[model samples]
Target chain A: MRSTRVTRRKLLRLGALALGSTALAACAALPTGPAKPTGEPAKTAAETTGLGSQPGPTTAPGGVPVKITFMMWAWSPENEKFERDRIELFNNSQTKVVVEPLIMPYEDMWTKLDVLVASGQAPDSVWYDYAAYKLIAKGQFLDLKPYVDNAAAMLDDSIYDQGFWKPAKMLGGDSPYALPIGGEGMNLFYNRDLFDASSEPYPTDDLTWDEYRNVAIRLTKEEGGKVVQFGTSLAWLQSWWAWVMLLWSRGVGIVDSHFSPTQCTLDTPEAIEALQFLQDLIYKDKVAPDPVQASVLSEQGGDFASGKVATMVDGGWDVVSFRSIDRFQWDIALLPKGPKGRISPFWIGGPMISKQSRNPDAAWEWTKWTAEEDGQAMIAKSGQQVTWLRKAREIAPEGAVPEHYSKRFETLNDLAPADVWSERWNEILDKVWNPEFDRFWKGEITAAELVKAIAPETTKMLQGA
Target chain B: MGRLARREALECYLFISLAVAGFLIFQAGPIGVSAFLSLTNSELVGTPAWVGLRNYSAMLHDPLFWQSLKVTVTYAVVAVPLGLALSLLVALLMNQNVRGISVFRTVYYLPSVISGVAVAVLWRWILNPEFGILNLLLGYLRIDGPNWLLDRQWALPSLILMSLWGIGGSMMIYLAGLQGIPTHLYEAVEIDGGGMWDKFAHVTIPMISPVVFFNLVTGIIWTFQEFTRVYVMTQGGPSNATLFYGLYLYRNAFRYFQMGYASALAWVLLLIILAMTLMLFRTSQLWVYYEGSVEKA
Candidate 1:
């Protein structure tokens, strides 16, 4: 009995010693702010514990719990409910990690986020519209390459890895700060009824700008100097969607062999030719408007709903909107080949890792999860957006998969030129390029002038702080 | 001092101290920060570096900044006079002894109580391009009304038109001034065998000129600070046709993260407004009338 009491005290001493040593080690190694802004090596808490390059505490004394702050743009009520429910399910499965989501309005998000990031505090992980990755250069976020490299061992190679080219490069071969999660590229969404009335085929894939113009003119109907069913409505319509596809068909683009900002390759004759073709669609053909004169975007949508346009380009994820328009019969087609190539302007959101994280191992785990089938599928189930994961490319472990979810991988081309362009793409596309292109679309400026305007503006936006 | 009296003094200090502290911390601090921020170049993510004359130099060439200033000045120039005139007119009309004058006063005062955003949205719906009720009514008259808020040319003017809808606060002030105008002055003018138009021209015009002056100066000050409506409406777009000074400042600071430049812009605007106010006041000595006046030396 006396020996047993001694053993109990001895066991307590051993446990207390272990706890005390851990506390001392933790005190000795506090997390300093990240070493450099863009390219800090991924270091985990285990390394802080004097655990000789092991990286992280794989298992806890009892069980370590992780908290991940995930943020995205605010969504509709139904979508939010679905996401929260799915997150709760994920939490149940992963006893270690807890994901807390933050949301703000879509349009207002970047402004608020810019402010928040300036304050030197950001969520553990965020839905980074990779276009804003330049903020990484400014020291707001982490270079996720190291962590992704670490997790590559755990990823199911066949299912998890197909769509990645440079793994890091978003567009061609620029810096890769994130993996594509959810996205939509432009697609030709047109009123089929308008096509039927005009005895024309819907603007299907494989049509060139010249071909599209011909069809647009064919559909255009004017009565008493008033357009009853105009060929198309151009709302927020810059040639960005057409430009990507057209530039690729012509092999003239902003990205070079590697995904870095190439010089204005399109500033030359081929790009001029492309612009002339687009111009033909507007003034010469008199099919689409000199979009500059179109009413506001909200009005354009209303006009389309009222059956005023035969063909229009809209985001693919917005299929539900066209589907819900009971007043008009509409259909969507994959955007056709442009003068350049078979490319479409895509908008994609990537998951970004925070620069300052209490648990990078956990954060990285979440990043991998978000990039993997489970995370992508979880986001997809919400139906707010589509995931870029070549979902069909998911080769389940030798017939473990149900058949239906696999086919979706075929349609998931998150690597489209638009998504490839990522965060700063919008700044150029929407802010700089789109405005000048608007002038071109308006015939206020020539295409050459539009190209000249973009060089300085795009150059300014590209320069790192 | 006695202990109780000292305690009383301390208590009084404590009572007012919270508000003073709040004013210093929240208001004054931000203003100082923004001013300091204006003189520096700030990265969106990193520490703001002091770039003494860089932001100002940049501002000289910044076409957007100039455009915004022009728009703001235009908006204020158009909106203030129109708003003040309409308010004064309504106040004068409502001052007549008539049925349910209280109700008329309430109705006139209601709009200004509504916030700027609500009023902007309400007006946007009214002035919508295609399906707005205002256009529908205009259509019946065989009018092909231009898209008011959407078109670059008409957008700023539409905002001006909307400003007239919410002149109630100014109207109430004018109403008070109109009431203060002694009825005996009108009677005296009438006793001179003057007509209604003549009496009003001599008496009513001079009587509320002080109120008009007050409204004018304040209107200009507030107009320079105008941001919310433009932000909500056009975001200074359709080729930045509606870009205003304050909205530009906000874009620089918040949207583009050029906080220092924005701050410098703000200080410059303050200086401009101050100069304009001084000039207006100097000129006021010419036209603006007070209850009693003596010739300047």
Candidate 2:
């Protein structure tokens, strides 16, 4: 008995020793860095990655040319290749300035950029589509108004539409901070086979919300007491963009007319009606799959991509993915109009000059070149997003688009790019409003209850800044 | 104190220098930094401004902090005991002299070896309301399954169930404890007219009590820190039903850029975990049976 007791105590001591060592190992394995900012330590521009690099030509004074670091959020192999190719093209085309690419995933982009700007190591130029106001508020971006005025003959404002250029003026003051390069507008993509199978006429450009809902219900298929197919799915419901578009279609914006952070207009009758209609589509009408039901098709492809959903509202960026769908015939149309009129949200991707750039002239030259027809044409050929420039839109590479794809451009005519690029916009939408809206989606609250519960808190967050 | 002993001590110090440096730099340094940061207001980019105790006061008034605390406690309370019990049961089953027992042990341990993200993604597919294999099996009995990840009422419980699946590590620990028990004790129990249940209760339970305590403490700590599955599967959603404290801290730090508040949250978590562990150690003397120690009372 004494020996057994001694053995058990020894085992206990051994276990403690083992656990202590295991914990030490775990501590050693932890990544060395501050949390939150998902970026490596800032490095000089001379470091070339294994992917590729080209040294700048000796053109400037003292036989050393100005070298500028150009970074953007490009993660996919194809996107990285495209960005690298564009860098090489730009570097080869000019001798006065050299551009190097610093690519990273989209999620890491803002965090890295914020750190860079704060540490006074910001790249000379960057391409970003969100959080414009945060940079503008910090005075981190160069005002391109003077550059644009000086190069008006070269820029030629008539080449771009009003909606395409509208988002560029997101600077707190009345100066353009970014020049538009590529963008897309929301469009309704429908499976022709599903409509034919349901003996329903194909949807047209001017279809109203009611007509769209009715078509969805008619196209929904159920057998053996279980729904095998859904009529429609929202392309990106998790984003505030869907809600914003829905509200816009009803002649209201999510924020106040001034896009003030301290106020939200989502409590209006039109907004409520729009939200309620979306809710009814899921719970009341059952035309669309709920969140869980939708996740099943996520692995293979999303609902519309996998042919489980007959129609979905998506942007032009989805064209590349949808084009690979050999399983069915699909095409695009305008989003359904609300009682007021037809309206869709537009997203603009562009390049902005950093305020801390040593070579501001070189940066402006690069930014200006990206908006030109040649740069826009490269984007058009990629089929990732529609080029906003008119000539690029008209002369997009032939194989890049499907037939009748010009309708995507036509839908951009009355595009309403909600002034949602303000600082605290993402913070409020993600932290304050999203969880409440999620509750509303789960049927725990009505649309009225949701907006009422979320509005004051959202206002508080907006005012916090 | 002798020359040989001094030489041996020098070798020990030399060998352990790397580990000691790592601990100070990676673990202790970050902990001290976070403690200091918890007293200040800093976004990731800006100069930290001293705001002593403000972050703590903010946490007191924050409803989400309380909700996340409740959720994490609920998860730990449910998952820790359930996981420990399931692990012990599996260990007991695997201890039997059955054919291909090693194969069974390996197969059971496979899930623990898989990455958390892969496991979460696999479980998400299994828990899908309409087309998942779980619901498909449930349908055979004419039972309509609830949406596992989507339903507010079922989401946390579903995550708890997922936690129960990766108990192979604990099972192996219990197996080691079970194997270490002397055969003479069981024989003595048998000689005293003890049945299997009596032997298990009097001998097996006492012998494995320390292992049980170890598993319980570790399981509780792990459950309190659960993040990856909740993030990959539900993202603390369907109305923040699965908002584990770790996930909430991550959101505060990364998503909201509230590094100061997140540091406060981290320190609070540390204190809570430390308190619980210390309390467990203090209380462990009452229930955990040890052999060679002097008897109290």
Candidate 3:
């Protein structure tokens, strides 16, 4: 019996040794090579497309001009053309670098970016949005702080708003990843024609939420048993920013006024009241269209632009697209005040250098140039965006602002920093909050119920962050 | 074997090498890698940690996984049979000796040829609650149409209805099957004083049972893997009612970067599909009519 037991033990020992060795072999085989940035981004792009190397201007002053790709989502042909023109301008103004624009549709941007980053062939510089940064921040984006620090004297640090730059650190660490390009503050854009048709006076800048609601309900018109115009429409329904702004106007948010998120304060009475107000606008008052109704009408431009909705909570960035609305006389005003104050949370996005970028120096130069006075001047001239640089805003080309709407920029004074700047903003807002809020939109749930359903999960996410 | 025979065998293998290479590289390799990944914790952005069966076990407890499974199973159950019936009905209609039958077939087949995005966009416009032509037409009939894509109760059904629009591919297959049926069989039925129902039940059904089986299996597989429409149309929204397994897997794999978990989900899906296919094959012996086979149900 003893001899048999010894033999069995030996067999077990051998099996264990073999298994260990096999595991060791697997561990060794599992891609230990560090993901090094490729020699040139353009070369990587060339390889991907099965094209021969693209020619560069040999007469460039700098040795072997750094060829880098700039990635952005071109949602429309007009946007693509505009970006292409600007890239050409950048190329003409530079000698040390040649920027190659890699424009893709907005829908494919995240998927394509993931593929690129995973394959270690990310563009040198890619358009970065704060909400999307956290998902892609894992060893993909370079810490731009060192570059910014080195070029501190040259860079106009004051050009970018402190609120705009504060959230850059929330991209996972106390290091700036992306610099501000352009930003937009929220505004209440109302149709004068709609107001005139109803003989309702135009809403004042300091109009309270109660007054705003009353006016909106009064302006809402139904003729021949069909709604000719809705009272109001709100953009960014799925974005937490909208709710955050509303809560801020009441001096609260998902988080407290710490300017950085820590926990879910959404269950508070004030937050619930704010959410209830928005909910009432859709269901009780029927002033604004429900999400489904809005989606249908918004397809024909937007509720505001389609003239189906009398008022819209829009942004300064909308001015570019809003200019195309020739059917109505529209103007912008400050967001309606809550019991506490009026607050319009600012949103900013811009170019960021990939950590995998081989040409960080050249990329930084390009990024810096993008934020420079000249670039800002061009952006301002386009009248589609709010320039970061104060100087550029001052030098905005003649007729950039509509002659009557010259004081539109005055709404900038009402801008407030968002309370939360979580990297998981995209997931929390789109995945968690919006889906639950959708139930509320469908009238399947009340405001309190919506908050009750969402708060715990949101709190967990915030705590995790 | 003779030298000539051996040479012929070699040529046959040489001709088939490209397909074998493609299968190994694209299909088999990824499948093998996914199996290995299922045992690990791979986020795709960091070093993978070996944690055997943890991902699989974790999914067992995940409410979303269970919800997605229910959604996917419901979608497959409803869509496969409905799609098969619609395609078969369309095929029967197209089989008639009518003028412009080919033109009708081509027109019916157009929706299948259109991209998923275009189809989704078209459907979005058609199903819009307020201004949609569907609702407008329904209003004319005094029927208040429900919000098709927005209402959770109606969303999945709407998708199933939209899926039926692209039944042309299967219709073409069924049409071919119908055309291939021997005329003598129908003539035999007629001579025996078989009515239309008798002929259809005895001759048509048996003759086309193989095609039906094929469509059933393929439809089940395809419906289970329906992602593009769900992603483009609803994005698994209206309170996660349309959160199909494919969309859930995609979220984990790409959006959330939980590649390892996604791989585990893939394996579970593979097993589920395999079991289903085997079950169908087992049942097929009872109903499927093979003309030349010695074994008959």
Candidate 4:
């Protein structure tokens, strides 16, 4: 009766109460599930592939499909379609599980996945990269070993290259958290035309380090004091993982151990020698482009792709971009061997089942299928990557443009996963390693001084500090 | 209170209710939650455990934290004052009644309205050491330009120089303030036998002091929150030389998934901004000449 008079104070109080209620209701109504798909649902695989009548797995119990979501970054329109097609094939192949594709922009994929996981509504499976080590350390992934053990026929261990399989197992402390799909390896990509113009022999599998530097210097051409063409491009050294190939090839590593390390090994004489060799390439020899010159070359097309550089140590994935180059013929060769041996970095990516998934069994089924022969065939046919399956590697380069597609396979023996399995990998790379090395690359600090400055911090990080 | 007065007040409150509700629900609510989040160990996965003040305490020993703070402060210190003077000068020129004045004004203000990412990309091209227009021009003078973004010595300065590109926004505000000044004041200064400098110092400045003050506060805030250019161009690299606080905070939140620590860092930023604004407000009585204000008199 007191507030029925509609006084100003009463009205104010009523409004306040209404707002508070609305806010509380909003907070309560917040969805505790995976974010709604930002992209349109892709056409069903049957619709696109003309395989509507193909037999799939038997229906789930009582004929209700166990719905699960598979999330991946929207790499490109074609890649998205390919992924959707892959998902549709799984759907057509299995009636027991219905997997929905959740495509997000590449930049937002990880952050959104983290939010979904935190909310206990993670996607059933996710396409993950090297950064998966952080989530794997958090125990966010299902231990796939049990699934692998149960389904030995479908998920055979012998089919996967140990180089790819070992890192998957190593990431989860010997519990396989993911199935091996494919990997990209670093290799020497050279312009055949540039080498031909220089009258220099093309790089071979047995090329040595000193010989590689000499080749770079000889091929480097000058036009009116400005270098028109660089002999070799060391622009790949900018990446924290890429430069470690140098250290690894030298029979030393940035850390004492690849898996578990207590101290920094970058201060070793061998390590400093390798790093100094890289610096001398820029400052002394002036054959390779420094960071500044690299930026300019990158703007044109790329150092190697622009045909301004004769040779480049880059990823095998460059085959995709290089395929578009009609200006010159290009091919791949084994990375130059160091004194110790020829070792290159390999980066593997695959789908990992989330621990919080409601249908982890279904997710496992999907994951295992992707690693099976059929999935490997599809992957190889896509020509997107070098499949990790031993059999698939033979056919992966069947229609590939790289003249020496076999060179990619040849380097498999020398390929080792970069030291990215640790949870602190990103932090160590971003906070300590890259910055100090940037100074080294710029001639602001010596390799010895760079190692000395970053060793303590890197050591602390490796010790789980 | 009278019936008419009460009814007027009620209507006023009703009209503003939507805005007030929006502020409380969206802005104030998140701020409150962020304060609570700052006290917890939320890693963007799993339940956030309450660790109360540990995140804040960790900042004390964090070298990157100190480094980012130093970088942000250095940027703000240089950018804010330099931006103010430059924008005021630009506004003075813009206020002149000349040919194609509107066109000139639009041209100056156009860059401010373009998207931030586009501006960043354009600047990246402009500052490119080898092919960039900056170095190309430097080459014409027979001076080899230092690597602007790649060098540790020049990265921070490069970002500071980029900050000046958007001064057109502040210039517009100053232009508004300049246009609002009465012509009688300049006439008075002229009658007092004062020249152009005296007229500017006594008439134009005092009248525009409030606008200057507003721009100062905003400039400080904007420069402190700088992230986009640095992110696109360097990613806080070439040796963390340009690692702004906002960039580091973003790294902690998204990249590292240390949301609690990032929340703590965000709160610290808020406090720093608040203290600066408060100090400015406290000192404003001496400089800010608000017209017909009893407090200022």
Candidate 5:
């Protein structure tokens, strides 16, 4: 036998080999494909208590509760707790089903859901917004119509607010895919202190476009050759969805049809005028900050809450952040009426059962429950969001900081679903619409030029050309 | 074969088997999968249908794809050379024997060690038009600084400028190479009636040509894959001025769910980098000099 000598070179090589082998083994041991669902049935409350009327866990025939996952994106700690509490309530309300909450960050929710879906480990139900139309087009959502038909008493159409229900139905096309839980409507948020300081009357619900602009100009305060306080801010104008509200209020739809759009109507004179109005607020009037300035203001502190701006057109959900503003008195009002009408852009979202759910019946029960009085009551009581159920909105907990917080529900009649309801919504916004609007905001291109440039491309995209 | 030689070869195989297996499984496997995926219409869910070169052909008509490629290539073109020059200069400065030099070196390299996202967030504030330090300094000089990330004309340039913050990484490598140069070579240059400039040009530069070459190649590759900073900061916004190729690929894969298109984009990026590296190697003979090696024709 030959004697082996240990050398530095051999030792280094052996070490590397060991490291490499360990890595390879680890990689080999890594799980592949979808993970098996970890929901082993839990014992039923009914088996122990034998009381059907009492609030207890319901179970399947074998005395095991069917487990389902509910995925939701929470914007804040309060929102997360609200969702967790709702899930806990539902879990305790029945003996047949158990719901596991999967809370994700709002920004990452869609991307994470896509990954979960692709891996065959998707949650049984997902809280979705207008973006859910893409999933509906792909037939990824279970048709809630059948579930609703079967659950007439629990999930009746008459009980829902048509403003949200209509869009929810439109989102699903021929069949309803989601049950309307709650929605956010765009409104005018004004700092009452600034209004008083400027000797301007508080904005009324009926303020027209011209009146709104004049008010903004009047309220604007300039000192030492610098605009100390803007009369109004176009902070939300950066989003295509937000600016499109101006167009909608002006009776200028981006597309000819909302349901099945073919031609892009954004090149119309009305649309250009609407967009130009916003552009003028920044350049011509200088009463509002540009996108860059708005971002800077936001970075420093809350733009409106910090008393930098007199008024802003924002969503009802902003109340959550505004509630923390103890320095100034703020209130919500209807958005300034455009040339056409007072059409407010409303973003409605709700729970959608995934088509691939293992226990779809259990998922449907969860979905149905969210639309029922209990779920809407939870939304109303939280004051973090507005309930879409007509009955629930009537009983909403009042005296929230905004004082006129219930005014959000009043705009339901004038609500238009935000964003173009197309499966290619994100693609159109990211590729064509946003780029042109960004240039327009930058003063690189006029509103007319921006609209014209994007119209043809947007039409082509909508047509799926 | 002789018994000793066979034994040695077997020992070498034993040492390398693990590495070869790892490379084959992880790197090579993904490369192959992506190549195949590039030829399909995978939405990352459901069955991916075979689309042949449809995704690549789609690139021909995709304006954003071209814009992203232009942005990435332009970034590489400007950032790589500038970074090399700056890092090399810093490396030369740090190579000097001075008091508290290690502290300076550590301070200079600190930014490079910071998390990319954290650095990006910090840069976002530093470049803000209103409250940013850069704009504040410009204000002091009575010059109105352009909105760095918000202005289309300035966004890409701002990112390129931000790239310099991490030059400490390459600077350290150059510093190592600078220190490794034999002091006798500098003395020889001096003995031959050469001035400081001559000593640097002939001795120092030639001695560190390999390090320069290494930095040049890596700098190009890294600049071409610039995504994290742009993603965290601008998100390829302000009219898509800072849309790097990597960011676009990421948008396609994760945002748009066009995995096949993203896979195609990845392959194209890989090929671009490969061609660039190969071109550098082919041209290196003219400038890159090695010590005690046969001169290439």
Candidate 6:
């Protein structure tokens, strides 16, 4: 007992010393912004296009120097660099429009824009999400119908008809307030090192959730009943593909067809089967971390970067971070097919135009450039952001990304459903989905109750206030 | 010569004009607009229309607003007395003529100087159930700590613990009050054959009563307005357990964009603080003893 007390005191002293430093480190790590005062947004290809050849705003007879800003998120420095190259091309080539780029945080950009637009301080243009069409109904967003019909109408029809653009185009059968920019879909990431080390059969395209579970169970090795590795987690925040798509494969939508929140269908018997399999990795099977243990490690982004888990549900962008993982070879695969025989795919974030931007024309031009094949390709290469454009299949080219990395993109693009387009889109969908989904993942609540839980809030939001 | 009076008045007005302008700009101007907003049914889309007393009537029915009020009151009640008592106890401990006392004072008060968000994030890690040092420490005592921030039942108390970490600042104020008591009074009590307890009981209580009154009133007022710490921490969640009034006001204003409703919430909060402070002053007659001839003062 005395020894325990001595050990206790020593531990506390050490913990305090560690915590003081950790706190200081946290202060240092808090994200900050630019040092200098704000300047014009980063110039885009549209603005800088044909610069020397085009007429100046006042002096030039034909070419117009349009100044515009486009807000962006979720691409690596490499991808951003490629996009920046295109922006220079546009600025140099075209005097018609000057589009600048402004980067925005992706987590919950829509609501922030909504607030901005309501206040009339919106940027000239933004890369708006499909759901940003909600602003059109409020009269906050300008109708694109006139532009789509008239001048500045060089958009591809194939891009417009893609499965993802349908809901936003109709605005749930209303008006199309936004045009498609580029997007990434979620897929399962599998670590090849773990597969070879355990001599587990690599997951195949034909595999079901059951086969996925078998792989997880087999890969899980226990020495003294503690798992060194976790199979999968029903993620709580930011990284939400595992929860959303897995549920989606079961035909449990985050919001219903009309955009009302339905109870978690993922928690239903079929969904529960998937969840129980996930839980078996933790509670019964003991192959994964519990909620507390899961959080103690780095975030999903960091863990995947370090190549810790054998398989995690990841977005099309996950491969962007795999550039440095020397410990293991990895690739993206379709989420194991559920009973639905459909791949669970979701678009990450959508761009929106601010209703209140002073340079609405400039903003529209920037928004157009975001969806253009060249712009999409540029953003993709600089950030390895796989775009949703019909031509995005050419992203990796022949020898750019390693053959293995390129193959993941092909599988993801071919097998995955084009991203779902919907209205009433905001971070609200994220809220109604998680925690309860997490509880459902833990088998704390029945799937039926989970679906019932989110219905009203979803209904109200989808209906819109 | 009489015109000199006008010149003097003009100079006096000029000197005070800047301060008055600032007060009007930052406070009075906003308040006037907010009052106007509270009477109208306004959406950010177009002009707000007059809907007198409608926002107040709506507040009565709003379940979330009431839930927020309940949480705010509970937070204020738990935090204020506990904070004051802890501060008083620490102040008493430091009042003794001990070694390196100034250094001790600085160390104890250091936490108060740390900003709210910094302290909250530190407490978040400390309170984590899985790998936090707090849980680890509690484990040595064989008490399995709850997953504090994640648990609705314990989230408020977890925030209270964070609030308590900064009580050192409040305690320092009390410490200064303690030191201000003359040593001669204790010597007088000693000459009369009074014990240390007697000296403290008679001399310390009356002398520090004014300080206690001041701290109590201000602490309650500030706690009622508390928002930032909770905003960063739980965001009033794990299912609305920590949703205080200020957070509710922010949501009504920013999230829902119901500025008029938020103004009403502000007014209600103002009235609540006024009532509580008035009650404290009314009750101050009994225990408080002031040395000045004006007893209440």
Per-candidate local distance difference test: 0.64, 0.76, 0.76, 0.80, 0.79, 0.62
lDDT per residue for candidate 4 within A410-464, as digits (tens), equals 7778877775556676778789877887778878888889889998888898888
Clashing pairs in 2: none
TM-score of each: 0.80, 0.84, 0.88, 0.87, 0.87, 0.78
The order of the candidates by lDDT, greatest first, is 4, 5, 2, 3, 1, 6
- Model 5 TM-score relative to the real fold: 0.87
Best by lDDT: 4
Model 1 chain A: which ten-residue window has the lowest total lDDT?
A: A45-54
TM-score of chain A of each: 0.73, 0.84, 0.81, 0.86, 0.85, 0.70
Interface Cα root-mean-square deviation for all models: 11.8, 8.0, 6.9, 4.3, 6.0, 14.8
Candidate 4 lDDT tens digits, B93-185: 999999999999999999888888899889989999878999899999999998888887888999888888999999999999999999999
Number of the predicted model whose DockQ against the real structure is largest: 4
lDDT of 2 by residue, A314-421 (tens): 887788767778888888888888877887777788888777777666666566666665677778777777775676776665354556688788888778665565
Q: How far is candidate 5 from the true structure (C-alpha RMSD, Å)?
A: 6.9
Better of 1 and 2 by lDDT: 2
Better of 2 and 6 by DockQ: 2
**Candidate 3 local lDDT, B26-60, one digit each (tens):** 56656776788889987655668999999999987
Question: lDDT per residue, candidate 1, A38-73, as tens digits?
Answer: 223465412221111122433333676677777677
Docking class of 6: incorrect
Give model 4's share of reference contacts.
Answer: 0.42
Scored by lDDT, model 4 comes in at 0.80
RMSD of each: 9.9, 9.6, 7.9, 5.6, 6.9, 14.0
Name the 10 consecutive residues with the lowest summed lDDT in model 4 chain B.
Answer: B26-35
Pairs clashing in candidate 3? A142-A355
CA shift of A43, model 2, Å: 25
Model 5, span B6-71: residue lDDT tens = 999999999999998777766765666678779988877656789999999999999999999999
The predicted structure with the larger TM-score, 5 or 6, is 5
lDDT of 1 at A67: 77
